[model samples]
Target chain A: MTAAVETAQTTTIHGDRVSLLRVLGPAHVWALGVGIVLVGEFTGWNFAADKGGALAALIVCWIVGLLYTSVAMIDSEVTSTVAAAGGQYAQAKHIVGPLMAFNVALFLVFAYTMLEVSDAILLGDTIVAKAGVEGLTHNSFIAATIVVLAWLNYRGVLMTLNVNFVITAIAYVSIVVLFFSVSPWTQGAVLKLNELVTPGNALPYGWIGVIAAFQFGIWYYLGIEGTTQAAEEVRSPARSLPYGTMAGMITLLIAAAMTWYVCASLMPWEYLGITYYPLWDAGKLTGSPLLENLLFIATLLAALASANGCINDAARAWFSLGRDRYLPSWFSAVHPRYRTPYRSILFLLPIALAFAFIADLNQAITFSILSGVLQYTFMSINIMMFRKKWPLGSIRRGYTHPFHPLPAIVLFCLCVVTFFAIFLGFGSQLIAMVAFYFLISLWFHFYRYRFVRRGDQFTMPWPKPQGY
Target chain B: MWMALSYACWGISIVLALWMLYDWFKVDTTYSEDMLTSSREGELEAVSEKHRI
Candidate 1:
């Protein structure tokens, strides 16, 4: 443990007192991950790789799932140690100074916000398309969704969580039905899967799809940690945060891989790129009227379920900012009636409404991915820092992290690689985001040191930076 | 073990979702302050001020 860096005595705002039942068990956390990523079909993830004849990409997806064991196992210990409300922001502030931690939170705010905004756009597009408008030709679809969902969230978290519990349930039901339907038909598919992994069918050796699949897998698994971010609302953070992250990842990895294999093996590779919503297409092909409606309703439910959870999550960054005095104090105030961050929730609606009205879904995904990658990278580093500072004896544990430096180094490198990979994956928007953040951060601290003086007075050995 | 159980639970959840069409027939507007024990401006402000770094 670092001699000087003792853990801070901080009990941050974890909204309202609730029953132990309110805290999601790991299963719900995992379900939340599956809900976010396993949309209708992840045609978006591997269509090109599948067509480039990357049969091996499927196995590579499994390989990446294996790596989640190492990644999530470590997260279990770290989250247990610091199960605070701000997720990575709390962890990062504890490890690095607030300045660097602030950067992480700032980027993370964009990551989750963009993700919610994009999902809202997708929701809008789906509803609008049903009405018979040529999609890309008009700006109507994404716009309508943002307006509706934004209003839904502005109303409250109970509304958000209650609806979330319902929709996420239905969405998951459809996914299971899809796998089972494929199972009845493709009885021998998984056993005879060697043919699918042959050289000709797989992506070329060392193909980028392997990495892209990993990126998608990791990003798709991004929000499990988010379950901890809402730790305050839960009855117990110490128990739920640790178990939720571990359990959730394990569930998502198995569920996603199994569902992917069943669908991918049964459906022709040629059909993937043709449909944005592949499960429904798969259902139509199955000729199961019951199944198709179930899958359609299931996917719609997922998008709906996820929208509420994600929107509630997005407001947290603003709420944290408000709590920390980065924004108005009102932003941090919890609703007296709702016990949720009303100002921050209200803060989120206008921005989401604006993006929903103005931007397309893919653009929102690109921004979401870029910002999210930064938070993930920071989180991996935060674990490493905690290892240096905390006495291992102080943390009560079932699973202990292997000796430091090695795991931390490996995690840090993977995080760095993923960060760069995301930048490349979303090309120019990433560059634009970097520029945008730098400008905003610069402007934020510009007039500082001259008049305003703020920072961690207790921790400083020397005088603090101008205005923190 | 965790993975196997996760799969089983997911399958079970599918059955649960189908019930949504029947169960969620009329929407219920959820209140935001599901956990607010009572209006505690004093406690809320104390908690709020404590948060300022």
Candidate 2:
């Protein structure tokens, strides 16, 4: 039962080495990324409409889209080389130092965990609202959703994400179907384009409001970068990571456009901004019970799909922390039979459930958005260090991002703008999140640094970093 | 009826959670630390050694 320290030479162990199953391909990767994000199109993104107007929300969507495009390109390049479970945290360890890597891991864990919480809560509330049964609360349904998804993740990633693919695809098609069903293309279509141009509907709160709207614009593509979390599990990190991530990004952009058009065209900006279920409301406007029922089912499916992917990702990031001894090594163990991170998956379940039970939806979404934006800020720095330390031709890269510094620069600038936008709305929460991470950084520096094997942290067999 | 269904949902979830926790501790005891913390990244490298990409 002695723990073997990793070394330059082999330290023989008594039992067979266990690893996560490398069965996932590009489709699972697409499902993993999109499944976590498609739910936003169904419900969350319209809050942007509330802040500014429908036009401002649409503007912010394209701007934030640019930010995530940079994220995808930079992530695809680094993950192709690193190919580990923790995604950006793994990249941070190799590119930056251990302290930054620790924080990035926390960011990934909290961001996904909080998103999972909100998704679960949304599922509970949605069911309760629709069921029309007095005395029924969301507590049981919330518990059931988190437990069932965690169980699915515990069984294996392949089936979990395969199910995500089907459900996510269906949720996405629900939007497209609503779009075609409304027939905005025809002259006598049902869409009210006049509502879009109404006084104050274009920019109700002015330029500052447009800036504030950028925060909610993130909902459109919040967890798309999570595709990188599957790096270790994917069969071909080189081909699959970029293909799945970029394809998922394209799907999101198209979905976001259609969602905004359909929702904004059907309702006034004031109401669209405040509505709980924008897509479902848009379906109701068509006066079709069939589309309403279809959207209702789609909303539930989207939430389930999102919560399922979050469990997959949050567990992986936490598992990576355990594997690296950043947290307790006990959390690192992979199930021999299922080849999944059973301990990490179990560890996050209660934490998510507790947060789902108490956390306000807006607060949960805000924290998730802040954590995600912070990770993108790290990506800018990580990519710059990656190119400088390794340079080109230093090692084989599976996918190389075009226009290197440009993407990094754009990603950083957009992250700053998004942070400012978030500050305008949730200034206290932004400051509070920073203070929390800062305290954790201090704890890691003083208490946790001793446990980490610094040499073992850099796992890749590349030449020595240049000018290091 | 709604109340009964709610309780049933909660009961099923709690049982599932308990089973996972039980399995978690069992796996910890059954496996060695070396086996659990083994470098899967190294194994991945070995598998793709012929083609580094």
Q: Pick by DockQ: which candidate is best?
A: 2
Give the Cα error of residue A335 in candidate 2, in Å. Answer: 0.7
CAPRI docking class of candidate 1? incorrect
**lDDT per residue as tens, model 1, A286-313:** 6778887776666566666565666667
Q: What is the alpha-carbon lDDT of model 2 when measured against the actual structure?
A: 0.88
- Considering every candidate listed, which one attains the maximal lDDT? 2
How well does each candidate superpose onto the true structure, as a TM-score? 0.74, 0.95
lDDT of each: 0.53, 0.88
- Pairs with backbone N, CA or C atoms under 3 Å apart (clashes), candidate 2: none
Q: What is the DockQ of each candidate?
A: 0.05, 0.49
Candidate 2 Cα outliers beyond 4 Å, as residue runs: A1-15, B1-5, B46-53
> Taking the tens digit of each residue's C-alpha lDDT, what string does model 1 give over B3-50?
343344345434443333232221112222333221221222223222
